[model samples]
Target chain A: MTTTSETAQAAPPAASTVPPKAASRAVRSKNRIDPTYYWMVVPVLALFAFFITLPALVGVFFSLTNYAGYGDWKFIGLSNYVNIFKDPAILQSYIFTFIFALTTTVVVNIVALAIALGLNAKIKWRTGIRTVFFIPMVLSALVVSFVFNYLFSNTLPVLAERFGVTPLATSILANENLAWLAIVLVTVWQVAPGATIIYLAGLQSVPAEVYEAADLDGAGSFRQFLSLTLPLILGYLVINVILGFKGFLGTYEIIVGLTGGGPGMATQSVAMRIFSGFTGGDYSYQMANAVIYFLITLLISVIQLRLIQRRGVSL
Target chain B: MTASTFSKPVNKMAPLGLKNRSGRTRKSGREGYKVNWWLTALMLVASLTVLLPLYFTVAMALKSPDQIGTGTGLAWPNPMNWDNFAAAYVATNFPVAFMSTAFVTVFSVLGSLACSSLVAYAIARNWNRRFFRGSFVYLLSAMFIPFPVIILPLIKQTALLGLDNPGGVVFLHVLGGISFNTLLYIAFVRSIPVELEESARLDGATTWQVFRKIIFPLLAPMNATVGIFAFLGSWNDFLLPQMMIADPALQTLPVVQMLFQGEFNTNYSLAFASYLMAMAPTLVVYILAQRWVLSGVMRGAVK
Candidate 1:
């Protein structure tokens, strides 16, 4: 996945043109170690090893123990992992997270792709409209979720009452069966703009000549899009889907701000479950959940890398 | 290839019929380029819908408690109650929270840039070496690991090391950001020509000197992109600071504001005002740097 040689071939020509040749020359002349380059990299590697790698390894180890967050512990030896399968709350949160992620990924991609196509067109106020759509992407998730929380709890209910719309009178976040939809809605709202930007890049990269050829072939707009645009941007679509899905798996702040996993834990995500463990004294148990989450993300990332590498090579 | 091919016809045809249909001619054949007024209106309406939350927050922030309860909250506040901002400012300990947030963002951005760029520089420059190649791969693979996966032990580790403060969060932010920022910098570094570094090396500059004088300066645009990204990630972060910094005094803007919301749950105007305050810095930064932010995000995605 991290093949430098492949990247050199795939990278755009302007910046990488001289570096590969220069690097090879350096390599041929010096078979020995380059202390300077090694020195330059040590700080970064040290930070990565200590903060990221070591803690990850420690986390795996902790999952086997009966340790609270602070105090000493006994070796539990997969009991927490065993309990994870049986614990209804943990299992329910997993199901909710998966459902939320899958739903949001589908909705966000479709909305973002449509908006990207629109933004890519030669429309009036294109930049202004694009900025407006992307504004939510910049705001903190907690803040956006809070604003929407108010909208759902206060503004929507008030407007609903005024219009005599009985169904809309209740805050959606408080509805046990339907609260997940509110979380999904806010997730898509915040995430779509970033996806739109990617799709816009993909849209821009489509050759004009290909579109012209489709036009001459008498393809309608829908046919042109299906036959030309989608295939061309399939790579970007895969990237967005995998990244979006993985990101939504860690849905924390949005859920916290909007629903607080409320109305009988109907909207709880795995992340919420894990963090809530810190205060609840189930630290090691949650570490096991975290390890599982890690593995799931890692699996998705491997698939993403494979897809990207294939596409990268082809491009 | 596409740009040159597409531009040639437009350039040649400019003299014949350029003035009247310059806009139309630029994208003459594409259906999306046509002047579809209805589609334009639809898009505008959609933009308004997307902006509604932001608009509603501002409106609610300006309303008084009585007006809000009276169900005129969506309407503009009569005489626009600005006192909500003052009240929220005091309630949320806005100054301390704002300072903490600023401190984290500044240090996180700087630390990420410094560390990631150095790592990226070494990898990009030494692309042929086995060690650097392996290091690059190692760093890039870390992108796959989510924060929650490590947060359990990271919290414990921070406590043991006595780094579980705002400063500790800064350390985590910088280190956590290394993977993505390194990826971005590596892409950008690949684009930079090695000629400048080569000349600097030829003039007796050490590797450090070459990077500092030539490579680092050329990475200014990428520095901005990575800086903005790091800034956004650190400033808006909730879970890390919320978990690591237990002391209310050391909490950042988002976490503090979340607490403020809980405390002021029924104080609708004050809560909305604090929400606006929490989001104001990022929104202002976005407005000022939308072009860079948009382009950087797009570019980052493609990578």
Candidate 2:
């Protein structure tokens, strides 16, 4: 709020004078209302309201029912949710989702930040190099999953045999613990590049003067980056954290494509569980799982936004 | 000044500097720091590590079914197999899927943009001190809603409205895109001086014409940014298309690719090959638009 006020206060007055007097007056009168604006949003808002927001409302209502596609919709007050906790598969999904989100977030940031620093430094064909690194990000997550599926099932096991740990899964997503590791690893490969690009942009935007000053004080690259570069883009880092976490929560295609969420209940994330229920024509039950997942995601995001906004405020 | 004087010389004498201008510094030689030899090497390895998988995908795309399994992890095929490319397309029913995906992406992105620009223009033009805060809060609140739950209800709603038509599902894609689209465009529109629209107004142009003639052209770059995201999201999207389109004929490319992989069962070569084929649209779009992303869209994006 204060930041917005500060920005507003700092803004220069609209000073254009070349326009006709009537034009300037109308423009001045319309600066805030821009009446045409709201109408344009109607179609989009209609879509968002119908598809994104409306369905969410339906999901909430459906959670309390026993609608299984074709059956009579009997309202079963919270029974679906109560059952969600008792089911070990659902519980395993909760645990797996948390662990997957945690591992992917940490690993992705480290790799992305390192890549960002490298790209920020002098390397050949910087744009070309950034694009090359970004290739994984551009490919369909499903395609990436298939690529990794081949890598894990066909190529990876061979290497494991020669330079092996207890061959985790014959297929990466099939083994419980190894499925978790493979999902994390594959996710890191696909996601890091985009995060790295954002970080690189943040890195590039750090003023040259600060680094020059650091050098003048005899600070080495590592110290200078720590003291100067990191602090300036702390907001961006936080943004990436939120993005990476949010991204992990919705990680469906990869999990489905890679492990199909299991040899049993190994890699089935919250989304996967919800999907499983829906595919079985158990809409009401799936809606409950989805609602719980949504609320949890909303809660985490709220906390994240508050934390980041607070840090951004202070910085 | 003194540091740059030092900065240039420190880079020249590293063992790998080709000219090896060892005498303090050569006139035009770039500065050398303690032979960043390790970073260069690490970067080389990192570059390969990232590229290797993609190279492998392309390799598998060309390899035959027998070769895909028997093939060494990284080995080049001796009798390079390219027939897999033709075979993947046929097996996947890719041409039909491709058209469906294109149609869906185009309509959805356009829908999202029209919706986004309207809302943004309205707010940017008419913001009152009191109302501005309320609208921003509402819009920002919309951003807080995570996306997974949107899928389940979408399944219900699509059934309710007979949105099972491939065309009908585009709205679902557009709906999901609106939150970001509005937020981004509103920020961009705020930066545009309103006087241009006012001038058009004074010339007796309607608000629609003003937007069409003036603001829309100016907003083109930002639109491209939003379009890129919308296009890619729509093109590569799996779930909504998976759920909404029941008929195999109506299925989008990504969904078809998924079905193709499973239906093939043990024939992993064709699956990976078709998968690569599916990715080509986004890959091409990203490569073409990648430059505009950082240089054009991002210029306005960063506040």
Candidate 3:
């Protein structure tokens, strides 16, 4: 609000105040509606409304009915929602998705921060190593998952057998108990680079002078990292966690490629459930589930926004 | 400045001059300040984690069926096979899928840049208006709606509108990106000095001209950031294309790859070859623009 007033003061005088036949015909008011700006925004807004907003609303509307994604339907009025809460498969997906999201978020942050610290250190070929580390981020997730799928199903077992490692001799993707770990490993492998870059940015933003001053105080590196580095980069940590958690919540493609949410739904995510339901003649039922999922995500987003705003973070 | 200037010579000479009474040179480097050999070694080992899988992809692609079955997966194939690539290429109709993917990636990047920047410019400049502010929030709200929630409805809608094709994917990509990209762009557009636009306005430039001639050029850095995200997101996307594009012939690379996985599954060499080919363009672009891509991702994170 203050910024608005400040910018308004910063702009030129309003166009309406000036006469029509003024010598200088610059008729502009930064505070007022500019038709050209309206033109620029309206089309985008319209497209967004038509594509995103409309579909979302339509999805919600259908959630109240028993529409099977086609043909005639009747309003079921919360029946699907009630069934969703009671369904074991749906419940299982929720449990798996949350646990997966949490585990991956924690694992990724730890690995990423460590890598970022290592990259930040005065190491040889630092830039080269950093470049190598980020390679996974640029590659497609599904392709990477396929490559890993082959590794997990074939190569790993073969290697494990020859190495005399009994526990890992069988393909982990076939093991319901252990398959989620494979997903987590691949996810951490792929997503850690992105998080590392963020942590690196956070680390780099802390002036070297602070570390040097800590050195003068004879503080150990561990102590300096604990008391100085962590506190300063806390903002980046929050950003990484919020963004990473939100993203991991919607895990889809990697699951599809790696395990197909298989070993009897052991690795199924809420997204996989919703998608399968859509095609498997559970349209309205899934829409109800989706609505609930949307609410949860929306709640998280709202909380994230409030946290960011309170911290005076730009995003 | 004074502390650094005074400390420089001492810092340089300490390693040479400092010696323990026991006649062995102590570790003069600060434990945290200097490189830890163990950390470097550990990181090197970690780097192998990235390199090894990529190595396997290449190795598996070139191996004969007999060789692949006989050896440890780490072994590289002798007289590496080029036939797999040709076979995979023909099987996947590589050029069409590649072109379809390329088409989506290019337009999505372009559309995201144009629309998000325009919206940001409008909302940013008119910050005092409730409508503009509300529009910003409205777009941001779209971010929270998980794509799966709306995808089923979107499929039905697109089919009815005769948009269940690659073009529809492009439209959705652009529409989907507006939220975060506008968030990125609006922050950037606000940072741009109002004086530039004001001067342009006084020069009888219309609002459109002011934006085009001044604001847009200044937005190059953010454009790069947004463009990189848009490219990667659309290029690597699987779900939208798989569901949205009704025609098999018009599907994107990721979806097409998934569709043909069954056909290639019996042949390890062929599957790896197809995956490698599908991965080639992104790898090439990343290698060529490594610096920009890395920095762009970092910049995006700050937002």
Candidate 4:
């Protein structure tokens, strides 16, 4: 090693050696590692590992055993995995989870994109309108769902009754097909504002020069949107998809408040399934379900992030 | 819907018909005039679907339970039963829950900023290190690793550490958020030029003095935005409390809200009343911070 270093130092006359020297210097510096950031993370990493990483590991371990929330944990190994495929309700929950995610994802994006475009138009009284629209996002999902329960499911029906039309209450949530749609509608309403806010931020970052060029080229609104706006904001579009997916996996409050995953367990998503299991005193089993669901969400999110990053348009 | 002293042709060309002056123009050749009017109107109605329900909520929350639950009381809660809010306070464990929430929110915010920023400063200002970089990426990816995978271990760890209490819960939340918090702060620290630090160094300020006296103050803007967001996030969080906080004395508002789901049947009006009560802080905070908050999100997007 000493001879190698001595030769490297002594024989480095080539032009390319300059670049290699810098690269090696970087490697060496990286090896030594600064303590500043590391020290700062002492408290954070302690908490992160304790609360986030450790619990995750415990959850995975719990999934492999029958803890019953107490008593000796029997190491059943792959039995939990087997029961996942075997149990119809468990498999059905996955299907419903996917549908819930897909539907809410589409609806939130379309509505948010439109609102973002409107906001981008810079209409009069927009701040007021935007404030009005964005207000729902501030409410916890439980709170939002309760308000909607009265307005759409109860009060709107009363108004409709006055006109002699059948009430439009979401008693249909007790039905299998419509229950999904009901939750979807409420979910879209609650989250659409958040998506709009993100998109609006993205839209604002588009340079005025790009738009000016589009206008000068005789590009109309649609043309400009197609060529300039869409291409430029692909990053935001992908982000919205990921956000929608997270929202789907994480959604428990609204589903719990609105339907309790009822109508024969139709609307019970993976999150809901875990929650229900927890409430029902089947803690270990549900944690296993959550672990499976988590893996699926992680795989999908990583794939999506990778794909978008690969295709991302660098500014 | 009222003609509004504007015309379609005008707004189409000029993007008019809004309630403000986005630019110095009255009307030009209607810019987006000929585009689909139905789509915009549909969007408007859809947007109103969000507003109208909220309107109804405010309307009913003003009424007595008798008025709200019975008869046609949707027209501004006849004579405005403002006592509904007072009743809501008692019915929902409002005071105690608020205290719990406030206490939790305070610690979560302070802890997150402190832990996240310290780590962030280290990562951003410190010299290049592969170990740190690798770990940073690992940490960021872990956020997407599904809560179920980590949540169980976290519970075990928290339990081991006696963090299952309310304060402990806040501690867990702060730690849970460290990765994202660090990401935000590290970015902020990197954006600060090195010249400031070099100048401080020339003046012989200790590293802590430089950070406290200069770096921390400079980071105030980004800190405000991130802090407020983290505060709001912790305050509104429902899932953790639902699973964790078992003691009624320690229950947050969202936890109390869940109690209305009684076995027999729920009192819908009382539940709705409680829901509105729970939403007050979030609504108030956003309203107060919106001017800065909106711009903050814009700034964050590029970073």
Q: On a 0 to 1 TM-score scale, where does candidate 1 land against the true structure?
A: 0.89
Give each prediction's DockQ, rounded to 2 decimals.
Answer: 0.45, 0.34, 0.39, 0.28
How accurate locally, in lDDT, is each candidate? Answer: 0.80, 0.71, 0.82, 0.68
Stronger candidate by lDDT (3 vs 4) = 3
Candidate 3 per-residue lDDT over residues B11-110, each given as its tens digit: 3211111122232222233453455677778778889989899899999899877778845667988989889999988888888998999899999999
Weakest 10 consecutive residues of candidate 4 chain B by summed lDDT: B1-10
| Highest-scoring model, DockQ | 1
Better of 3 and 4 by TM-score: 3
Question: Candidate 2's residue-wise lDDT over A1-315, tens digit each?
Answer: 233233334444453543343242344332334444556545545555666667778788988999986668889999999998898878988888998998899899999999878765645555666667777766778778878887887787676666665554265655666778888888898888767766755664565567666766998888977888888888778878888998798788888778888868788888877876666888788888888887888888879868977786221
- Cα lDDT for residue B202, model 3? 56
Candidate 3 vs. truth: CA RMSD?
7.0
Residue-wise lDDT of candidate 3 within A1-315, one digit each (tens)? Answer: 234334444555654754442313333344435577789988899989999999899999999999987789999899999999999999999999999999999999999999988877656666577778888988889999999998998888888999999899999999999999999999999999889978876775676568777888999989999999998888899899998999999999899889999899999999999997657998989989999999999899889889988887642
Which is the winner by TM-score between candidate 1 and candidate 4? 1
Candidate 1 lDDT over residue span A93-198, tens digit each: 9999999999999999999998987776556766687788888888899988988887887777888988999988888778898889999998999889888877
Q: What is the TM-score of chain B alone in each candidate?
A: 0.87, 0.81, 0.87, 0.80
Q: Native contacts recovered, in order, as a fraction for each?
A: 0.63, 0.46, 0.64, 0.42
Residues B140-183 of candidate 4 have per-residue lDDT tens digits of: 86677655445544554656666665787787677667667777
Q: Report clash pairs, candidate 3.
A: none
TM-score of 4: 0.85
